[model samples]
Every structure is written in structure tokens, then in C-alpha cells.
Target: MAEFLQRVQSVVWNRKLIRTAKGHYLGLGPEKTEVGDGTDGKPVYTLVGEAYVHGKMDGEAIDFQVENQILVEKFELE
Candidate 1:
């Protein structure tokens, strides 16, 4: 991971631990939702910045949700 960081330009390390539905840890900035369309009816969330979600960084979230029959949810950030 250190080598990968070194190759990138303008990187900032910030720790804001967020827990997903399955209790997975996510290191990311807060997101906001604004009224918009073109999301195919799926609510669009405007990401404030970058994210580094462990385990679920790939397609694990989708698989987890599918296996556990978890429904998609959205929260309006204040």
C-alpha cells in the first residue's frame, strides 16, 4: 500500500471510520444527497471525497447484501 501511495500525486490521509450494513469498516469522507435524476430511480449520493472501504472495496458489498437479503437503503446527510 505504501508503494501504491508513493506513485500517486496529492494524497491526503484522513481517518473517518464508517460502518456498513454488515459491520464492515470504511475509511471515507461523508456523502451528501442532492435532488437529481438520471440514476435509473436509484437514489444518487454525492460523494464528498475518496473512500477506502476494507473487504467491501471490491464487489463484496453486493454479494453480502444478496446473500443476506439486505435491502438497499439511503440516508439524507445533515
Candidate 2:
């Protein structure tokens, strides 16, 4: 691992996004999706989720907000 980092992408001293192992995770999108409970009761709001990891890098970041079970706002990465 040390030798590989020295030859490949190195973020710091010896840290790198390796290739020997594969990893992934679900990431929040730039929009906030919301789901509402339409039951025969009180009005309820639930935040919904869309696609997992976007078609970007592994360390991309996003922001989202939900209100009344609906996407209220979204923020872009600076």
C-alpha cells in the first residue's frame, strides 16, 4: 500500500483511493425529496430519497432540504 501510494494518487503523506479494493455507498442528491402520508389521519410529512451515489467522484458533496413531504430547496457544491 505504501509503495502504491508513492506511485499513484496521493492525497497526503500515504493516503490514497486505492484500486486493490472496491467500495461504494449511497449518497444524497442535490435535491430534497419528500413523501407524505395520505392516510385518513393527520397530515404527515416524510422525506424521500432518490438515486444513491451520483455519477460523480467518491467524495462529492451535496445539500438538500424537505418541507411538507416535498423538495423545498437544494444547494450546489462550492
Highest lDDT: which candidate?
A: 1
Q: Roughly what TM-score does model 1 have, to 2 decimal places?
A: 0.41
List where candidate 2 sits over 4 angstroms from the true fold: 1-45, 62-78
After superposing candidate 1 on the true structure, give the runs of residues whose Cα lies further than 4 Å from its correct spot.
1-5, 13-26, 30-47, 73-78
- Cα lDDT tens digits, model 2, 15-78, are 2222211334333332343222224355444433333343334433322222234454444443
Clashes of each: 0, 0
Model 1, backbone clash pairs (residues 3+ apart or across chains), number:
0
- Clashing residue pairs in candidate 1 are none
TM-score of each: 0.41, 0.15
Query: How much lDDT does each candidate structure score?
Result: 0.57, 0.36
Question: What would the C-alpha RMSD of candidate 2 be, to one decimal place?
Answer: 13.7
